[model samples]
Target chain A: MTSATRRHVLQYGLAGCLMGLGSKSLGATTSSGVTDSEIVLGMSAAFSGPSRGLGIELYRGASAYFEHVNRQGGIAGRKVVLKTYDDGYQPDPAVKNTLTLMLEDEVFALFGYVGTPTVTRVLPMLKKFQERQIYLFFPFTGAQPQREPPYGPFAFNLRASYRQETAGLVQNFVNIGRRRIAVFYQADAYGRSGWAGVRQALKQYGEQIVGEATYRRGSKFTGVMRDQVEILKASRPDAVICIGAYAACAAFLRDAVDLGLQVPIANVSFVGSENLLNLITQGRDDGERYTALLVNSQVVPSYHDTSIPAVKQYQELMALYAPSAPQELLTESYTPFSHSFVSLEGFLDAKMMVEILGRLGETPERGALEDAVFSITEYDLGIGEAVSFGPERRQGLQKVYYTVVDEGRFVPLHNWQTRFA
Target chain B: MSMPKLFSMPRLFRKTLFGVFFLFGVIGVSTSLLSIYAVDTHLSKEYEANSKGIAKTIADASVNILLNSNLTALQSLIDQFIEIQGVSYIYITSETGEILAHTFVPGIPEEIKAGDVNSTTTVERSLPGMGDFIEVGSPILAGVAGTVRIGMDTGLIALKIQRAIGQQIYLICIIFVVGVFAAIWFVNYAAKPVDGLLNFAVGLAREQSSDGAKSQELLARNDEAGDLARLFLHFSRPTDGHGKGPQSGPDRSKE
Candidate 1:
């Protein structure tokens, strides 16, 4: 018999077994408990933790996009139901919540799950459900682990990863003839990943990390920052790479200034939180003694650029969907990096999914969906880049634009495409 | 030789072993495919970016040379374009199809004559700096109106891609081997309980008789399976035990 026929027979047999076992009751349902018309998507994010700023910003962005979609009559005529759970930047609860979403809530797919550890825990579970054809997109982590296939086919990345962004940042630094770099990281996966990139980039120049320091999450680091300042003072490096959140980065900068370590402090894109510059400026105890030391790289374009087509579209969407949010929040600095492009990314991926669905012509099986994603080529997202997928490569956008904090604003450095170390 | 049975197969343990092996096999194939995809994507992107960079660099260098030089010197320097590693040919022309300078390969059409400075040629080919080979007449520079054409062999880019793919395949193989072992260990861990239950069931099925001594012996065996057996025995004999016997055994089993 043909492979198709054999597959049909096996499917029939599996269906018979499932029916006999009565495992249909194991499926998760919604609040109204509807399974067919409503498509539920689960997202676990750092909604109320130290990283809540990013979490809240991303939520607002994704919500705005979904609201716009729903208002426009939804995807393929079916409305998307986003069920968000707060993971509080912790992994244990994140795993529990994810299990609830998958096993109890039975979401159609997992969209916008945030954090590396949280997503890492769910990888095996996601692999198990690969046969069900669950699509995971814009997982907040830029860890290469998520983008590696068989996981990559199901998981799509929206933001450029820390590795890609850091490479751009370091290359720009190198272009400007700055070596003798110091690194201040969060002592976490996110921090270390960017650190790895920085180290790799600096390797080309025959330079090593001259000075290093780290901060534990949620700990007050005034004294620790003082110590780090002393270390950086001793090392006297040309640039200090900060790979922590806004608060930690702010503390380090303030302390570094007090210690007379007047080196330029550059940071990864994660430090692009709202009012980060305000915090740095606030830490400037004297009025005229403003240290010319603050610099942070931005992965996305400044939302303030009203001239950009993508930004214009985002503004329109925000006005229509999330009118309650302040106009300033939608400004260039305050807007989430992903906010500028998440909807567009979603639309592009959704478009691809629809094409695959059309190819399947009504009920596309899981294998067909996999094939469609794998077989993609010249798939233009209409944002900035075109996406192509083949038997071996799966990442969508590999380019990152570096911007430094200039006069309390992010100034564009030259754009650099990502490369593997 | 002795005649073999039509459907001879291995024992239950061996079957389970084969199942585990098959599971790993699926994971390996899928992982291989994934790694290939990841590496190919990474390299192709690198190649495309590199090509674009090379093109831009060549274009920039040509513009710089033209901008720094006057018309006579530019005409003399145009001949030096071939000396650049990736530049194939350089053509300098006016808005009117005048052959200001020409670096030609042996026997192409003489579209432009030396004194024919006022005739126009249509743009035919979509070459980088100028247009196609046949109709290469349009003016690139507006006021000065000169064109510089450079051709690069994409062989280096291809070689880079190939090298990247090879490296990636090796990395993927390493990851695959490690992942397979991890998957096997994990599957075995998850299936341990089921394996224990199956063993217990087989043992029960092979039991010679369901006598009092066997029942006492089963009760003495106080693990989870023994508790299940005791409960089963008590349920089968409705009135054999003292004061709610089935209830006690079931309550204990439930706990």
Candidate 2:
């Protein structure tokens, strides 16, 4: 099924029944996951497989902030504890893990979910149990399912949506006279979301995507991507936009370089740019130059720009706590990034969640969460940007950043005209 | 293998019944063998050709994926082909001879992995627990991309042959039962008239030329037996006690 941002599904919660596992789960006194001493938040993200970095790094960033907060004796003397599960970036497992989180584990809320496909499938489950006042807070996706009308009420987003990112990329490409754009995406809900974004953005300029190719989800870096490259190369587009995970995107980039499809390839934030860079370049000066014509769109600013208060704080807390993936969920070993767009977003999500918890006072209740978040009409997130929420505004961020590889790191691409022109 | 004279009928009738049964058996067995052979040969070819076609398709589709070194996509590509009925397994190897993707559970069988990896369009193999298979392999991009191997179940063809043979045997049995019923009906029609003629001759030997009901019944018959009885009556006088008729079996009249 195609993943549309939002529809008017009444009771637009999520898809599964909590088996009546609503407020009744915690009885008449308090919420399900919160006790007098600890506020437990449930998270179901991709902790294994190719997309595991998204889950591991996001969890690490958010939990580092939570750990630091808990050290200072948590909000109003209540510690924030995260309960996590690994979904391997698959929809069925995501749905199953979410049910266990809400029903079996009975967490206070769902948080830090990694992928669009997983969150989209779990949206109906939330819609199914809306009366229980179950809410998903600041999941790691910018897809419309969590931001639009139907399922928007159940989820709150901290990062800019993929549509916003794509709109920015498309506008930038056209501004530099690179209008014939093509797309290489995974053949699933997540890919469809990014592809639709590009299409809608191009329509604003009276143009459309010149070509498109797709690969199955969960493709690895070792895959052959010449077929997809060939399909798009036939259209002879000036630029290509990619919507896929790091491994598959790396393979596509590798094959594109080998097959001589020399055009600027752009990836959205979900591609895990640092991971993509590592897979293709392998940290050796082989002079392969896979990044010679690559651009990436991010919802969060560069973590290297410590001048921003949030970035500085995120780096400090991440180093001080040095959070790691849950030992049980560590199916593979990945060297943690000192700074990345994904982890920064997760840190901000945690910061926002703390602000919400602090507003709830000592005796926190699940029913008061939405109203409390909507009350924040003015707040400085230290990111040099205004972060606010209202009854109508579910997303807290609306900014997108563009970056290109320089000296083996992603630096902001401030001069797009000089490069693409 | 011979049926004895168990019925109260003439020896000639028993001989005719035995001959009919033997002929039916010979024809029935021959037909069964011919049908089994035709199905076995034809189905084997069909399965082999179908497997080769499937292997070639996978090889063509996999070139891009293999060139990209995408084992996951290659596996997914072949997964769609394996669902076809005769396909039991599928595996792909890269140009460098490394196993890229395989549909084996608990890993590929040790025999196939260590043995001759080279396979033509059709290679028959009995892989222990894997049953019989007719393997078909096709090269992608003329061996630049690698090879796609598909193993189709030969046991399925054998099953079809068995089913065909079973139907033929059932038909043969039905004909044999019909023959037995027809033989019983023929014995009743021919044997009774011959017995009547023999009884009349035995009575003439004792000077009892009186026209009994049995004699009258034989004469009233419309068959050749009735003509023979009338001819005997014309040729012999009632006083001629030395009446003649062919004698066969035990003569109970003397006893």
Candidate 3:
């Protein structure tokens, strides 16, 4: 080869090597690491795990909102960066990933990290960080600990809690004069938390759980659920409450119908994934036979209808940034209720982060962000609800929008004037 | 007396052409695939989000209608929902399984009929909040009460995604066709230098017996061809007759 050619080859090889090394170093640095022009928020979600759909939905919702904010010159001229990591709904990796974001990457906050077990494991670490005063807003879990005092000061809950949701579910049955109620709950913290709420709500009616059934998560409870359905039927309870995920809830409904036990089947919000509706109607000869399906609910403003200002804004942003997406796909059916929940919450969180950043006055320290969240009172998101936080109450949403499943979709029943249950 | 066709082209020129073509082919194909994947992922996520957003909008509008005491308003709301870009139907009911309003085909069942609502029949499917209906519920006013359910036809979204995927695949196919043609051109160009070298060796062999005395003169030309001529002379020495001798043959063998 010519001398010049040999030198050229050597230079190209060195350039390739240098590029590879640079990428490796960049990859090694966690995404949460913020710079002067941008602040990164970290999220670990069940992107590929059992609850992967929920995680993916949450990510989509959060990303849509963030993309919109960033387009509008971002929050106070500092671009918001959401660095999402998928933990596959597992707790160990979630804790590890969260710690890496907090310690190594130094993210300004942790936003919308999903899953109950996953968030539960990281609670202690989050508490430590909170002691140092870091903001963790709108974590996906509605577990009581994350919302109760001590840890509640650090965390901001976006969804109506299982307690609040269950109270709403039971209150619906109570409104219908269904005095004898039974709860079929998953045997976990989520189910227990909801069941506790149901029990507490029923106490006001001078009654208790007339019939209760529990099943493990991810287990096929068809036969067990059938037995529970039969037992619940025997008790002749006016309504059946389901405090579980979509799979369990769908299976219970399918099996209950098979057993010919017909009653109002109430469910928690977690069971509200749109896939469940398809599962329920998949092969049924009478698609409308499952018309009595009811999903107890909480949701933000709908993004499908252009009638609402907030929903219209959400659609406009989604179109601008995500134009390739089908216009119809922007509807609420596919995402279940998560799009409304996360988008509204994510926007509020973005606003709150901006407010906190403003409180710090130009250059923000982590301490100022924490104080800002704690100091928030009646921060409204234009959805007719004001988010308030105090020393005692960390959960911002006091109102729950109770919705029901009518004809294979969730329609709002009404906003409860008083907190149900 | 005719020079070989392959040896007519200079080896360096042929090799340079080959290197350029090969580099372009590799870079082009890799870039196309990477771009397609990135675009596809971005679009799929966008599609999913849009579907969810549409569903939420219908639910919200329905909820507002239910909150108002006007059943006529609720019916108008359902009609508006059906008029929405992607909505298929909107149904409203009470927690007691009473079908308050519906936007469906004719022949509504007695159980789901508007006036003949089934108060005895409760919603039995396992959904989130318990009620007789599917989607959102009208807040219980002093007298107003019911559930507002909105159903969206997702086929439009699916069709949109399919079109996007089809467009991507078409682009990918175009790129692949271009890639194949480029690869063929590259492989041919890359092999050209080797062809030239073979012809040069044949030319040297043909002239070998004719001008032993003039060989040194031929090798003195200060070009790539002359360099090869000199190397050939050094290799064809009597001691390297077997073409595997220790001294000069090893260097040629290394080449």
Candidate 4:
């Protein structure tokens, strides 16, 4: 009512508006792991356990690319740092590591998680923390849970679903008149997913799995499974599709070989082809070729195929970077591969993540991450396939490649009939 | 005058009770001891067998996980088995005798670590502070995949046996108390007639006549006591009539 009182109120209002503007300007560094100088992404994968190769190699590959980018002065000039934790390929540990990555380390996004069981468990965490704009990017699993709702919107994938890989394996085998296929898988979500994929693929041809056996997840190669091999052998399967890690699969192969069950054993890419082969043929004077009938399905192009530009770049960058896995994660002595499919996929995931970040411009915010990723209509990954993501499409690649061991190395399988026969 | 009464009852009544109690004490105590032994033996055997079966199943199921050297899954598999009753601990070892997984919380017991639990047969082991155990081992892959050892708690087995024995003891105590009450009631019923006959004889010695009807009443009953009373009346009546009374003796009857 008085002149002095009116003047003071206007002055206070002007000061309050100035403070709001100042806070808004400071908030530009926005999002937990995003800062003016660095953007950190979180990864919770199996850096240990029997499947540690998957996590380690995936990390190594991603790290190789991140290093390459950082050397070129980072993603959009802001250094990209990956905050990683080991889940040992188990679900409970995966959940714990995921929480630590998001809440404690406050990583910008979760990326490169290594297993189906792990990712399925972590999906709920992302859905719950969606308000924080926390999303998982390009996890290294082909399980269907992350590709479908109500968990689909929470993640963006760069690999083909296990369904695609299994279906391709099943179709190829069935076309070769191998209808009586048996399955041996790990007794977990990952295994079940592959089994379901095989079942779904077989349904189209009116075929069913002749026999199935399961080994517990994390089983090692020191144990023998002659009885399991016998169980499957009785089915008189034309072929066996094994959905498991390299250790258990290799051990199964040993028992199968010993039992004289001379049927083709097909393994998915998650089995780690190189590791499986090495495990089967590592010792003894016999030098028996255990991989004579072994086949593996992969989601990425063969690392040996230098004709593909992405593979060329991946092989070069991986060798140049020579990214060794985090030492403590080496828990046991695991000699890193010079180049592999798993690492190649990891390299592609890292490159794609960088491209997505590049779209957010200099000031990247968590709120705009999904849109930035979706905005890419067709980004050439130089793998002869275009990588794309949109509202309707969450995965970038749908191709599946098959490989077989030759001379202790995995080479692309083209002549399926001759090779399998 | 002779021995203090355990319960306020006549000597004959007390004697009858003593006979009953003595018989029951011998039989009840022996039966209880036998039952305790039998139950303990049966449970020990039953639990030992169950634990062995568990160890065997674990060995069969653990082969793949063991072969892969996946200790986490191996640990989880064994951990689930420990939830079974009487199963106290589970330990897994590699083919070369390296430890892979165990269920002990404070670290594997030193005694267990040192004890040879790898035998195919169930072996009994007594740890210093951890009580006794029946350790059973099953060879995975017939010793190619090492062995699975499960320890069934002997202390727990003994405790269950003790609990069973405790209930049996309580039942015996209850039966004894009921038996005593029944004995007391029977004693009161049988002793009343004898007491009547006792007073009559004592009265006759003091030259107090009468109670002939009471004597006849006791004689009318058909029991060993009644028969003895009749025989005594037959002999004493004729002798007293011949000439003996209280004045004939210096009160030979002692009360």
TM-score of each candidate?
0.51, 0.64, 0.53, 0.64
Question: Between prediction 1 and prediction 3, which has the larger TM-score?
Answer: 3
**Ten-residue segment with the worst summed lDDT in candidate 4 chain A?**
A1-10
Better of 2 and 3 by TM-score: 2
What TM-score does chain A of each model score against the native chain A?
0.77, 0.92, 0.80, 0.92
**Of candidates 2 and 1, the better by DockQ:** 2
Q: TM-score (0 to 1) of chain B, per candidate?
A: 0.45, 0.82, 0.52, 0.82
* Superposition error at A211 for model 3 (Å): 1.9
Residue-wise lDDT of candidate 4 within A287-357, one digit each (tens)?
34577888899989889989999999998998798999876445667888999888888899999999999
lDDT by residue (A1-421, candidate 1, tens digit) is 2343245336534543453344236443222212323445677766554565555565666666567666776555545556666666666667776776666655556777766646655665677876666667667666655666435556766567777766766666666666778878665445555666677678877877776666655433333477666766667787788777766777787778777776667776666434355566754546123235555665455565656665566666766766222222122223343333323333333444334433432333334555666666776544556666555665556666555444555555433222101
Model 4 misplaced stretches (Cα beyond 4 Å) = A1-28, A285-288, B1-255
* lDDT tens readout by residue for model 1, B146-220: 543333334443555577667766776787667656654555554444454444445556753465564556555
Residue A225's lDDT within candidate 1 is 78
lDDT (10s digit) by residue, model 3, range A1-421 = 2343245335534543454466456653222234445666777766553355566556665667677677878755667766556566666678887876687556678888776656666766877876555567787656676776445666777566777777777777787677788878765445555666788789888888777666655543233466557656766777788876666677788877778767777776566445456567777767556646454555455444467665666666655665221111122223334334444444545555555555655555666665666677777555667777666767777566656555656566653322222
Model 4's CAPRI class?
A: incorrect
Can you give the lDDT of residue B48 in candidate 1? Answer: 42
